[model samples]
Target: MDINLSLRHLRAFVAVADCGGYSAASRQVNLAQSALSRTIKEIEDELAVSLFDRTTRRVSLTAAGEQLLLNAREAIASFDGAFLRFQHYREGLSGTVSLAALSSVASILLPPVIFEFQSLRPNVRVSLEDGFAGEVVDSVMQGRVDFGITSLPRKKGRLICEKIAADTLTCICSSRHRFASKRSIEWRDIEGEDFVSFALSSSIFEVVEQGLRSADVSLGNITKARDIGTVAGLVSSDLGISVVPSLVLPMMQFCEYRGMPLSNPVVERNIYLIYDPETPMPPASTFLMDLLRRGPRSKFKIPNGVRWIDYPDGSCQANSN
Candidate 1:
């Protein structure tokens, strides 16, 4: 037997069986009475069986029709269920999105965004990994994570990077440091001072190196750390003063440390959302990426005691007011 019946035929057959008449099922299926009757006839013709006993007053299902009714209802239900499942996935209400970011950005910046996203899409799962900027970029490039949040990479080949926010570099030191009480300090002032810096592979290290070179200053007795938490710990203990992104202050566990903006070609790093443009991002990940692109600090509530430094578009002014 060549089973050449379509879903429309099954739906009309089920409706006619349930409604017990062509006119009632026609209204239920939003089809004209004639069209509905023809659909039922097509299914019966294809199956080579009489499915309905019709008269001027009433209509009844035949034995063949009764047997098909069970299977027809099941088939229609399965089709509808499958369509709904796909719709949920397309709308980002369900599925998983994985992302990688610097530890500071993950701990301080992602909480509000993730919380809000979870509240709206409780069924959608979000997984996050934290590391240095280089590691984060590697994860996204290797397809380990869908996207990454970090400082813009030095190499931009085969990747799409979008700036999310302006983060100014700040001088972090214990209260005992002389410049600690100053609202702003110049790079020259810290040229001869002991400096705690990030690992050479980290993006922050590159930025610091370039800024110092531009100002004709060199780091003295440098202490390098692989993680920002360790850098914060060293600074809080008054081991040495370090330059770091102002946004990292909130995520660091240290207390009693002051943040002063760097002057004389003030160094500011723009945080970027990086992903591979070749592969399509998942619907849930795309939604989160859009949220991040809108400027996380502006779209979401910022923590207290931290002021937002608005960088005018197309300008690089990062001096603290």
Candidate 2:
């Protein structure tokens, strides 16, 4: 026999069995008595088994009906439970959000936001991956993560980059350095100074280099480090000074250093939230994205030398060029 059953058939059969008659089952199922009878008959025909014993006073389930009743109830419960879980996911009450960000952003910018998000939706899990700017972009592009937070990408390609915050480059040096006494130092002031430079792979390096180029100033490159901690360690050792985004200052708090806001061509590093427009973000991911887009001015505290950029409609694309 070719058996094909719809939920309607199973539900009608269960109602008839539970209510013990067509008249009462019709009321429970909101179907006319005649229609309810046809639905039960349809199930029986499909399964090639008589499911009910009809009596003038009462209708009772047969052996086949009794066995199916157990499975049918379990099936309906499982289906409904699945839908309820999906509802929770759609409402951002539960599910996981995977995010990738630059090391500085992951450490300095995301902690409070993640805390607030978890407080609001405790069941929602947030997984964060911290890496260099290029790795952050790659995670978003390869679909390994839901979104990325980083400085503007050199080649944005298909990524939709939205500027979320801006941090001015600050010159960091040992506390005992001569520039520590100055309120603020210009780019030219660091000329001929021993500089601990970031590796070429670092986005900060590019911004600082461009800023130096714009100011027509040069520094004696003492060392190149790939990690921010290494850079901080080197600068703290008084080997040389370094120019880093102000957002990174928080990470260097353990090291003894004085950060002077760089001027004479203030270079601002624009941080962006990037994602592939082709992929649809989940509700949890969308919720977190909205929180980040609101920036520090809304509810989060803005760090020194860093300012939030508010987009008129809550978002705007970066100028990839």
Candidate 3:
């Protein structure tokens, strides 16, 4: 048996097994049907064992195929990692990392990270996508993006999520807002105010709604939009006041502001970088993650304070001023 079987052959085999048949696997792996079948045959010939027991209606993994699945996954991961390491060593720094983040973080935190990331490693390319925090998490879990930076740690399981920052949540109003002059407002203070919310689809909105409900507050005249930036824009135009993470508060100068910590129930969102443990990351993503681990604390290009607090349970608090 020849050990000269290429990764493509193993990939073809796995695709067929995963997709239920060669025809489907060909589409999944983006190989032509004939090419896919040929590669699988080559792999079977190399190993001198029937990998898949194929029938007209379905494809099933035989003993050899079942045995190969685990090794094939590991082999693929190793190959990808090797390419990444090679790229890292060759250009001293290379790879294009794809990152998706919450709209707020994209506006405030991402600039310096991108700037520092690119300046430190000139060869690496970075693409940034912004969307709902949940969408960002979904992107990371689905392997559509290498990493996701989001403001809420609402869900657990599927992917590994770590707290990168304890982002403060704030209530923002436009300059013309009637309550802009108030020193501080309670949870019930703005309940009846026209509101531009962080979309009904956002789990952040749900978290906020829970808090509001706990305090017996109800939102009014809610306008739903997809991202925080849109919510902020509408707020700035006097469309309605909205609740947003405190990190973005510094960016809304045209909007009137008071940074009162929500009390009777303080609201803080722990932001995280999410990545899939089961899926493999490319070289660019691996290096970028490494740099994140070693670099100085990330700084935002705004005047916001993110002072740290020690949570009662010994976890860090959202105060990084």
Candidate 4:
């Protein structure tokens, strides 16, 4: 049998059954006695059973009504509980936020922020995916993640990119290298030096290449490495020096290397928060994005060579140097 009934119908039935008479039930449910009688009649007719034995002064439930009462109460309670949980999710009290970021960012910049976010919304789970800049962008575009953090320059019009921070490129070399004695090294200082270049596919490679080209300097490319650890290993072995964003220095700390600030038309790699403006994020995701947009420098101690960008009125502006 097709049981086409609404919650209102069940509520009316329950109210009538609980109150024991139409006059009282009508008062409790805020309906006229006539309307309450009609609602009870509709339920009885649909089920093809006498749900209540009508008396002059009171009504008593039949066996079928007794059975339905149990099930109806359970169904309503279940629905109410589910709705309460949904409300919590909507309020950002509980839900999952998935995010992607560059490996350097995931390791260095995000830990303290994630810790603070979890403290505020303990029930909200944060899932972080670490990858290259291109992978981070792809995750946001494909809806694989709620948002992404990357140093890759904005190339996609579909994405709404906001610059969150900038890290200066630094010349990384062995501690024993002559460049380490200097406070900072100009781009021309590394000209004709044996250089360990990042692989062509690396996002850092493109930035370094552009910066070098802009400064009118060239290096004798000795080797190409894809992994930061590999580059560190090569440089520590006195193979050659390489230029990377200052944020990358911490990862190479175990190796004996010094990061000297690179100048002569200083190149700053801009970090961006990227998301598809068309997609609606979950409450937890939106909350995390807001925390990030507030600028990490306000909440945590950032590295020396990195600067947070000011995001006011949805426009990108550099923070005071």
Cα RMSD of all models vs. native, in order, equals 4.8, 2.3, 16.3, 4.0
Residue 318 error for model 1, in Å? 23
Q: Residues 217-301, candidate 4: write the lDDT tens digits.
A: 8778579999999999999888899999888889998899888889987998888888887898899998888888887446766
Q: Cα lDDT for residue 9, model 4? A: 82
Sort all candidates by TM-score, best to worst: 2, 4, 1, 3
Better of 2 and 3 by lDDT: 2
User: After superposition, which runs of candidate 4 have C-alpha atoms over 4 Å from their true positions?
Assistant: 18-28, 53-60, 313-321
The candidate that wins on TM-score is: 2
**Candidate 3 residue lDDT tens string, 1-321:** 329978887788778888889788888999899998889888888888998787879989999899999899899999999998797856547767898987767777667667877787788778989888778877877778888877654553566665655565667777678767765567888778888887677756876776688789877798988755577678878888777667767566544444555556667666666777678677667666655443234443433444322223222322221
How many residue pairs clash per model? 0, 0, 9, 0
Q: Which ten residues in a row have the lowest lDDT in candidate 3?
A: 312-321
Candidate 2 lDDT, tens digit per residue, 182-237? 88999999989999999999989999989999999878856999988899999999
Better of 1 and 4 by TM-score: 4
The CA root-mean-square deviation of candidate 1, after full C-alpha superposition on the true structure, stands at: 4.8
Model 3 alpha-carbon drift over 4 Å, by segment: 1-92, 153-157, 237-239, 250-261, 290-321
Q: For each candidate, what TM-score against the reference?
A: 0.84, 0.90, 0.60, 0.86
The TM-score obtained by model 3 is 0.60
Residue 276, candidate 3: alpha-carbon lDDT = 72
Per-model CA lDDT versus the true structure: 0.81, 0.89, 0.71, 0.86
TM-score of 4: 0.86
Candidate 2 clashing pairs, residues 3+ apart or interchain: none
